[model samples]
Target: MTGTLITVAPTGAESSKAAVPALPVTIDELVATAKECEALGAAIVHVHIRDDAAEPTLDQGRLRETVAALRQSTDLIVQLSSGGAVTDPEADRLAVLDARPEMASCTMGTVNFGDGVFLNRWEFIVDLHTRMQDKGIVPEYEIFDLGQLTTLQRLLAQHGLPYGGHVHVDLVMGVPGGMPGTAAALVACHQAIRDLPAGSTFSATGIGRSTIPVILASLATGGHLRVGMEDTVTYAKGRPVESNMQLVARAVGFAQLAQRPPLTTAEARELLGMVAR
Candidate 1:
């Protein structure tokens, strides 16, 4: 309810550099994008590392290096995506924690991701949550569907609270197999969030064309925003997104208009219960 916590996911595992040239694939590109987004009011950088060929990778060495470089370059909360690629093995995905990021994403449930299924078995979800708790890495739960909220409650009641003791989630809307990005769906999700622990916060990201609609609905509903080419390549009809900063700036403007503005890096850390480094 203070200011919006804007998180910029510069590159995801799905896009290819050959197609989305603006996507930041290399560590240098990721650093540059993180710096720019931080300056544009983004408080967190949700990262997904790529191999030399610009393809998604769960290589532990590269992941560690990327985490170190981002920490050196920017004050943004470095959050590595534990859901690497739908094809990523459970061992590799769990090993993402060895990178020791300030925070990491933990998808609550499995959902269809385009043509492939993103499998998050109950055991896998509990393992991811328990490991994050043991490692003291804060988790930004990724909810892809409505029922996932129930799964989150079950996880919390059974396992215990995540590291940092703050519960924050990212609603990934409009995925072909997930919930829609309409205001109605967002409102329903938001309503469901009330059933969570008090002070729990949520941010929403709408895939592709659902970007602006989700942004508008999130702001109107007092939620945070996540934007980047990871969720959208086309800025508008027939117009391609130029850069991640473009999306961040637009979200900042919306937050400002809503009078929520954007939270600073330190403020974000405190809000999310992240230990200052």
Candidate 2:
């Protein structure tokens, strides 16, 4: 198996400091988390910035500052989240790419997100894809369902190539309204993506109880991983995680046991075809 590229999603739009105390909401906390995760063998930090109130935001200044801090403090690849919060306006979502980070996320399609809807229309997806291409930002396509994989195929067919030309995707499973997080489901998703751009890679993230199963499946399937408080707050049943580094450490241990150690920052960059910063 290839060296696993572990991406640490330290904070997500859904969780808050009150719910997950160790969540890195502030820039300082985020930078500290990034450094520690990198030291624990995380090659990338998938960032979601929060405001003073600890609410998610796509504020250009905050994002720009957060990106700068991560760049200065660690060698980890900093990827900004364009899926800021479900309620975020489309304009603000598009503006996130303006922060000019090395990487950003582009959801393949809309899905029922719990009680609410996570909206992503074809026009919005195309616009984000084009803008990322213009800004030289590599996109990590976020897929919540099997059908979204087909949407991605259509995207590449119509848009030619995404920014950076290399394709990387994230299989976000076990959401309340999306695909079930199971070994069979993950393998099916992986098979579907095989028709994508040649050499396209993927990372699997199983939220809540599905976390461990997804990690094992990805490891066994020659795919990468996305782990942290963003997708899971618990280290085990009834056990809340203490830090993102803890989650990353466990992933590194698993990868190594499988003979696929975590990828270094430089190796991750090369694997993803990212431009040097």
Candidate 3:
């Protein structure tokens, strides 16, 4: 198997500093986290920025500054979250692509996120995909349920290939209302879309308790991994994670033991079809 691509999601739109104190909220904290995670073997940093008050916002200025700061501070591939928060406006979410990060997320379909719905309508998905293509931003398709795979198939069939023609996906499992985070679920997701996009690849992030299981399963299945506070806040049962670097170091250890060493920033860029920086 090729080297495993490790992506560290330092912060997410859902959590707060009050809930997860280690969560990086400011641009400086995010840059520090990205640099530490990169040194610990993470090739990519999945980012979500907040306002001065640490509340989620899709403000173009903040997004641009966060992306630029990350780019200047670390060699890791910076992937901005277009799925800002459940409450963010569609126009604002779509406008995030204007920051022009190396990559951005494009959720395949709407799914119940906890008690709220993450509304990604067909037209919205197509529009986001088209815009990402137009801006030369690579998309990491976020799959929260099995049926979304079919939606992804429809997307490719209808919209032609995404930007670079290299399809990459992230199986965001274990959301309360989405697919379960289990080996079976991960395997089923892979099986469903494995044959659709030619040379397509995927990574898995199991939220909460599903983290370790999904990590092991993704490695065993020849897929990559997405880890850190975005999907998990605990280092173990009841153990709050101290830093994103801790999760990344643990993943690198696991990948090494499995004989799939972690990919460097350069290798990950090549693997994901991103131009060298």
Say which candidate scores most in lDDT.
1
Residue pairs with colliding backbones in model 1 are none
For TM-score, the strongest prediction is 1
Candidate order by lDDT, decreasing, is: 1, 2, 3
Q: How would you encode candidate 2's per-residue C-alpha lDDT over 154-198 as one tens digit per residue?
A: 999998787767899999999999999899999999899899989
Q: Stretches of candidate 2 above 4 Å error?
A: none
How does each model score on TM-score? 0.99, 0.98, 0.98
Cα error, candidate 1, residue 259 (Å): 0.3
Candidate 2: lDDT of 79? Answer: 90
Cα deviation of 235, candidate 3, in Å: 0.9
Clashes of each: 0, 0, 0
Q: What is the lDDT of residue 16 in candidate 2?
A: 76
* Model 2, TM vs. native: 0.98
Candidate lDDT scores, in order, read 0.94, 0.92, 0.91
Better by lDDT, candidate 2 or 1: 1
